[model samples]
Target: MTIERFILFSITAISLASLFYIPKEKYRQALVSFLIFQAFTWPGTILLVQFGKIEFPVREFTQATQVGFTTNYLFYPMIFVWFVIMYPSKACLTKRFLHYFIFVSFSVWFINFTTIYTALENPLAGTLFSQTTRSYITFFAYYYISHGFIVWFSKKSNLSIGG
Candidate 1:
């Protein structure tokens, strides 16, 4: 198996395993940190290469574009978790689009600019993102599943949203 596939499998396994341990609130914090770590690595790596000219030691082994901290990973899961986590505390405004769209539009626009620049220099290094492929099953798909369980699991325990 390739590195990317291995990472994907490991992410799936660990993410699934996270569900069973949610009764203990402490683990959830660790889980969130771990997920954030997974999200941060690739984009951060590509950014470091583009700006700093750091020659990282690794071969390109995979081309799966549908998942794994590309562009869309952060946004949708934030949306899913936002609703469930905030629930009654953070009031969902009637015009949800008004609040959320600007953030997405700006992020996509800004990131696309960077992507264009980076792709010109090092094409294979960065996450070549598109709209539909953002919703990949391998990565963020678990968030929706875990979001529901997390909401339910956290509700059962004394855990608040952030913790």
Candidate 2:
């Protein structure tokens, strides 16, 4: 297997192990967010290497010294949305998460397209990463929205998998 795949598989295994360490019921509230963080960051990074477009030749830029961002940087924090949705308590955590989600996501997108992530770009993926400080926030918004779905799904499914 490629180095990227090996690294990704390792991360996935570790994340699953984390899940095992926590109690399903208690963790369910924050499960989606945590899982998303793991899923998108490392695994997503691998996928970007595997399937997402890259600018430099794989071998030469092993360090991606010439490139700006690795694939996982932008996708990492999206778990916030999931945090919002899957927040199992009767408390208003979901509402708070939504507010933060909207704020953080917009901020990341605005910053990115505007200039924040300008320096963070990979030479190879000049525009492929499409990340700016603002883009990071947008990704968070995605996480919040996804968490909403996870919450909705778990409830609808009537399964305690997500608590």
Candidate 3:
């Protein structure tokens, strides 16, 4: 298969495999985080594609949707699940901020690198800031907003966050 297809398939396999790593006691937390994060990613991805900010040229469900189904609906949410479950809850404000920075930074870097190497156009390239800058902003926004929602949900449900 082509490298792009191979990369996508590998990502899918890894994401699926990550699910088994979640502890049994945290299964409920994992499910809640996954579903809630998807609530943000799905529409956020669609809007990004719709407005020409991004495109997944090699993606599943192309005929049904322009969004990258595997990345938006599955991979990203799974990442968020781990993020919430492993959060450094007792960390000071600076460390907490660093956590956000680290996650967003790595995600954006990996995404930009992979998409470019895989022959997909970089999202929001040259919109205003450089492509990497714009991607950082976009990813940080998604993570921040979804994290807030997850925290709120956990509070309302009386569920504890962090391992």
Error of 3 at 110 (Å): 1.9
Put down candidate 2 lDDT per residue, 1-163, tens digits, no spaces.
7654444455445544555645556566555554555554444444544554432232224664432232243323332433454454555878766665555665355334323233332333445355443346445645656556656756755457867
Give residue 55's lDDT in candidate 1 (0 to 100).
34
| TM-score for each model | 0.30, 0.38, 0.85
- Which pairs clash in model 1? none
lDDT of each: 0.41, 0.46, 0.78
Model 3 has an lDDT value of 0.78
Better candidate by lDDT, 1 or 2: 2
Residue-level lDDT of model 1, residues 47-144, one tens digit each, is 55566533322223335421224323443334333334334435466544343444345434534443454321222333555321331322334443
Ranking by TM-score: 3, 2, 1
Worst 10 residues of 3 by lDDT: 120-129
Clash numbers, per candidate: 0, 22, 0
Which 10 consecutive positions of candidate 2 have the poorest summed lDDT?
A: 66-75
lDDT for position 158 in model 1: 66
Model 3: per-residue Cα lDDT over 1-163, one tens digit each: 8887777788799989998899999898889888988887788778878888777887777789877777778877888888878888799999888988887777676677766687443465464247778767877787788778767766754456862
